[model samples]
Target chain A: MENFLQFNSVSYFYQTKDNEIQAVKDLTFSVNENQFASIVGPSGCGKTTILSLTAGLLTPSTGEILIGNEKVGKHDGKVGYMFQRDHLFEWRTIWQNITLGLEIQKKNKDPKKLARAEELLKKYDLYNFRNKKPRQLSGGMRQRVALIRTLMLEPQLLLLDEPFSALDFQTRLLVCDDVYDIIKREQKTALLVSHDISEALSMSDRIIVLSSRPACTKQVVDLSFEGKTPLLKREDKEFGRYFETIWRSLTNENQKTS
Target chain B: MAGILKPFGEVLPMKTKKQVNFSQAHKKYIKRLKQEKILVVFLQIFILALLLGLWELLAHFEVIDPFFFSSPSRVIKCIASLIAGGEIWMHMGISLAETVIGFIVATLLGAIIAILLWWSERARKVSQPYLVILNSLPKIALGPMIIFWVGSGFSATVVMCVLICIVITIISLLNAFTSCDQDKILLMQSMHASKFQILRKLILPNAIPEFVSVLKINVGMSWVGTVMGEYISSSAGLGYLINYGKSMLNLDLVMASIILLSILAGGMYFLVNLFEKRKQQ
Candidate 1:
């Protein structure tokens, strides 16, 4: 498989009034085309920074990030980001919110793109809620709406920054399955940043575990399950073994930091 | 459990056997709500009538000296005569024009300045302290200087209203623009949106509710500014009438001017509130 997104020794430093803080250091990883990859790390372990760097919102202080063998630059159109919060403009109805990117891109007049938006809404069982405001939707529905909004842009890569963390436990599990299904069905490459081991293990084709702040790759675990869906994969015989491996890797990093 | 199919294809839950009893209870709930509303209005009107009667009686008996206090009937008589003479119209019209013009100009100019500040980080940083100082300084103290600069006329009055309203507008609007969700902005950036696109699509829409609230605040601030300006230096206006009446010891005219001012201010507030409600809907 061809690597769709690559980070070559990427490092990021945040400059404050008093001192400089290194958030990411020598972080090297890659997500192949049509792959669901996740980067799991301890809290505040620069997981979000990695997503930001990949999305070209911030420049790597050292090393390079590439999408399809090209260097990532500011406001890369090939990348779509799904934030932890749905970030749906409450004032806008679901359909209007979904087309916000198209409006910004000046592609709102395109019939094809608008149809895709309509199709995604219907595909995700949100057709009935097309005219409702985001606040009127449940937590899981809002997350689905957020994903649909991102997918509307038709980017080559999707960057999800702890997209399920804001939801309740039950909603989180359901949304995780929903998102995994959507990403797989769309045949789009995805890089998820998460701290939940089960979440990453269930959805990701490969999981890259990171050390605490000044984040660097600690281990990269490739996953294979006979079950097709994330929920079904959660019940796989090897699920516990993968969980223990990722858990111990994370806990070891925590002990090292302390 | 099945539901009835409506003409519009909506599913209406079937009325259950036990639920039939709720119809009477619902009617009683609605009746109680209506009675409560009517009772509230009646009590409010009764309270106002009682207060006015007491005030009129007190003044007639010379218990509170009507010369200074001025009874409601005297105020009404003064208004009636002024209406007959038709001089109050000119004063009311001039004050209304100054206040409306000032309110509009201040809000637009302040919002524009806020946009400029939000667009540039350095501009916001440079103007932060100056804005704080200008916002805190007593604007009334600048009344004489404004008159000196713009002359003691309509221009000065309008300038006073703008001065009082603009700083608060700038501060509030700038805060609203800056405090917009950073992640939403990032989402826009991920779509490769330009700075102007982000502002137009996200920042401007996000700040609208705040702008409406600012307009509501300006309704009162504009009145204060216009009145203060007239007090400082004005040959015409409701404020001028009140000031002239004070100097002449015509308490009836002063009280009448105040009453007119209150009515106009209340009307303006009501219009703005109505506009806000429509926008919310």
Candidate 2:
């Protein structure tokens, strides 16, 4: 498969009043078409910053980011971002929240997009809650709605920025499976940023480990597990081996940084 | 005793197995709530009656001078005569108009200024200290300046009300707008939404409850402004009546005006509360 998203020696700097801090340093990686890529790193390792760059919320100070062979730009509609929090407007109903992008893009009048929104809600078992406000839903359900809201825009690539972090462990596991299933079913390329090694191992086709800030790619491990679902993948015999490899890489990075 | 009991099951019968009557319990719970509400209202009325009775009894016995303290019956009689003579209505109407106008203008002006401040970081930063100073400064101090600037008339009274309320509105609304969740704003930005779109779709909607609260506060503030303005310079209004009655040493008219002012303030507050309820729904 061709590279759908690429970052070429990307570097980013954050400017404060007194000093400039390097966030991401000389990072290079690529994820192929329809592939699920996960970036695992230590806490505060600028994993979210990298995702922000991909989403075009921030621009890299050096090198280039390419999405489908085209350079990334500010507010590019080619990418969809799912934040750590669901970030659903509490005052708006589920349907209204899902259609928020369309309204912003002035495409709400488009029947095709509206129908797709309805279909996604029904497929995800959220149709019954379409009229309900976001607060009325469970944590997992709200995340699903957040994902569906992003999907309504039909972006070429999806960026998941630790979307499951806020959830409890049980809900996290269930939501990981649900999110993984939906991404694969949609056949869209995705890059997820997470600190949870097990979570990355279960859901990713390719796992890229990163060193501490300013973050640089440490290792990229390609996996061929026996099971399709994340739960089943967790049960795979090799799951433990991959977990150990990533954890050691992470711990080594932490040691070097400290 | 055991033979007489005939075993627990035989004595009570299996059909008589204990079961909670949920409907009856629910009824009793609802009745308790109703009784509490009634008791609250009754106590409130009793407190008012007690206060009024004490005042009336004291005034009747000349323990306090009725001429100075103004007895409840005198105030009531004064209100009745004012109504019969059809004079109080004009004053009430003028005050009400000034308050309503001031309340609306102040709220809108404050909201607009807040939006402007929110739109530019430089503007917000620059104005922060000034806004703080303006908010803390006594609005009544502006009464004389407004009377001269706007000419001691209806305009002056309305201007006074606006000045009092607008500062608070701007401060509160700007706080609301600035404190909007950064993540939600980023969400909108990621979708390529314009600033206005974000404000309209997220920030404005998010600040609605704050806006309602601002309205609630403005209702009271505007009344204060109007009355203060009228006291400074006015030919008509309840404030004028109070001031005029004071000059004439007619305590009954002053007390009556005070009562009327309370009723009008209460009515405005109730309207704002209704608006809040409707928005919540």
Candidate 3:
């Protein structure tokens, strides 16, 4: 099957007054349609640069990125990005935040789009808090709201950048399950960037391990677990084995770079 | 008598002891809250009374010369006579009108100019040095030039108020606009939001707290600019009254005018506070 998203030899660099810092080099990967993929790497290993490139927030220094077989542009609406911070407009209520993209695109008045938003909010259990500001909700609920907001745009691909790293351990586990459930239930293609090996392993069907700064694709690991949710996946016997492999790949990459 | 009391208590035994205890605690909590509020009011009044009494006593004992210092009682008397004569109303109206006009116009114009600067990076770079220079210059130094340009009157006062307020508004708002979370802007960009849409949806909403702060500062600046304008040239205003009283050495009138000016400025500041409170809610 053709890839739903593709990075064709993508590379990125940050230019400064006196120096240029290569963030990613010759990185290439793809996520099949409706597949949950994750990119895991060492801290500051330019994992986020990959997401930014995919979202077309930054152009690749060389090579190209494609979504749904079409090239991505600087302001393409085909991609939805969830940042580390919830990034919900504090001044706007949950409902307003959800519809922000639609409002910008001038599709907010469409009945079908509004109904889809309402349906998503209801499905995610955020319908009741629709009128409340983002701050009033707990961290997990806020992330859910953020996810729902991005989902409202109905992007072809969702890029989650450490979406639950800000939550406490327990909340992170629950949010990971919730976010994974939403993405799967919606049958949407997703590409996640995480430093947590277990998080990447449990949530992703396929994982791309990246090397340290000037990151390149170190290895690609495909995961399958009998358990359904991320929480239950931790109990799967294969979970430990998959964790070890990804951990070793990451550490080995770190050792070589250091 | 003990048997009768026991039977009476037994008649009300349907109410649980826990319920009675909870009700008692709730009542005490409410009463304490009320008492705290009353204490705050009482302390405020007490402070004012003590300060005024000290001023009156000092003047009475000639520790501070009453002629120059003007005791609180004399200031009150002066105010009472002015009210009775009804001439102070015209001056108060003139100053209030000028200040209000200046405040509103300056705030709106400042916000628009800030938006313009934020919209264009080249424009912002070009205007940066000029804005810094203007903010640092004493606005009052432009008084003579303003009068020459606009002719001394309410318009000139408003121009002065704008001069005092607009630069600070631009600087603070530009800072706020620039400092809005870059990630949020990127999120909007990924949604294909236009620059103007991003400004409307993200930057402006993000700048609200800063905007409220700017308004609060402008309230004082507006008053300063208006009073300074009146000082330079005004036929009637509290500032004019103060200047006129000083010429005649009628310190009581000068003290009364100062008191009125403070009250008016305080009232304007309170209104801005009310706006902020509403926004927060």
Candidate 4:
């Protein structure tokens, strides 16, 4: 019930030499601790902008964004982001990629952190691949590796921006399950940005829908289902109703904008 | 006729060895062979045969002295003599030392400078244009000036090689570091990585392929700079041997020196290629 992250009337604009294009306007939201939250809406609805703002890479034009009761800027390390592309360095062995944060933080000497990294690789069945490069892995495996790389940092909240959009449908389903299990097992909270209504409905505790460009939060739904995993939940008889409701919310908003 | 069967069982490209149909496999082999060689092979064989035929023709006509033109056979004999006397090895050793030292120093200096420049956006903005301007200037024009400053010594030759090669290394690697997937950098930032941490873990590691490529380009450039420096001033080196051969009108010596230079360049090229292959693996 308590807020773990808050966006207080946040707005963003990109200023070029000629003009300023507003990306998001007066956006306000809060995510509770340990909640799996997702944002879904039309293309270019500032979904990615929201993630960037939350990560403190882009300063909000009008209002403040907070993480763990502190303004985002005051603490830069409390968030973890996974992108649309896994963006794993091709030259690094999988083990090296996962431990990159620790090495960079000079935490390689910390026995506990190093052990946790190894344990995660073993648990994920990527242990055998620890010596392989990112290119050597399949697309789904690379995404899992990317996720593990973020988890190694052990941040308070993980941000995924359409993380499985590039994957084939079959791989996407399996990866969605793998990702959810990892988040739960690690006891880490997450905020995912996706376009898949079914993905948002199935994987998230709450879905935040935004309006089109210069986006603002349009609706929020708290989802509950009678199944354990995303694939199982997709088979739930009520899945159609939930999908329809979210679909109408997105489509109706687009109609209003046009 | 194949249309009905087209969608059924296409093998993955990786499975090319085991699963094959004649038309597709034959076409693929043809495409690959065409890609691997065309102009380079033709030019190589043409150059070889033309030189030999020209030498034999000139000797037959006696239009110019064989001593000055130095028929291909005479050049080969001179090469054999140089190798037999061990003079070629000594001269080659001196040039190789200059080239290797200069190359290593240039690469390190360039990498350090690139890292420092990359760390500060303001520094990159200010210095990048000047570097471009410096690289644009012909390095050979500065050969004599370098000889004066370093007094036509070994260190001056090394400095010349470094001067020629450092710009390329810095430009290539700095580009590589900057071009690291922005998403990945953002990921690192969210993990609360420090600037130094990102450099050590993400940026530098990602830049390895590019850095290796830079070494490949610099191998030849540094050799050129070192040999040019030696030719302009040094008392010993393969370049000096060539310059002496030219003054004495000994065409066989000149040809021998050039063959020796090619071997040195080819050796360095092979070493760099090996490094690249290992990285790829």
TM-score of each: 0.94, 0.93, 0.93, 0.84
Global lDDT of model 4: 0.85
Q: What are the lDDT scores of the predictions, listed in order?
A: 0.91, 0.92, 0.89, 0.85
Q: What tens-digit string does per-residue lDDT give for candidate 1 at B1-281?
A: 12112111322232224644568779999899999999999999999999889989999998999999999999999999999999899999999999999999999999999999999999999999999999999999998899889999799999999999999999999999999998988888888889999899899999999999999999999999999999999999999999999999999999999999999999999999899899777
Task: Estimate, for each residue in A1-258, the C-alpha lDDT of model 2 and write its tens digit.
Answer: 677899999999999999999999999999999999999988898998998899898999999999999999987698898989999999999999999999999999999999999999988888878887888777878898999999999989999989999988877888899899999998989999998889999999999999988999999999989999998999999999999998988898778667
Question: Which one wins by TM-score: 1 or 3?
Answer: 1
Q: Which candidate would rank higher by DockQ, 1 or 2?
A: 1
* lDDT per residue as tens, model 2, B139-174: 889888887788997999999999999999999999
Q: Per-residue lDDT for A8-121 in model 4, tens only? A: 898999899999989999998888888899999998888998998888888999999888888888346788889988988776789988887787778989999989998998
- Kindly report which residue stretches of model 3 are placed more than 4 angstroms away from their true locations once superposed: B1-31
Descending-TM-score candidate ranking: 1, 2, 3, 4
Better of 1 and 4 by lDDT: 1
Query: What lDDT is reached at residue A228 by model 4?
Result: 78
Worst 10 residues of 3 chain B by lDDT: B7-16
Indicate which candidate wins on DockQ: 1
Rank candidates, lDDT, best first. 2, 1, 3, 4
Residue A182 Cα positional deviation in candidate 3, in Å, after optimal superposition: 0.5
B-chain TM-score, candidate 4: 0.82
**DockQ for all models, in order?**
0.39, 0.28, 0.32, 0.29
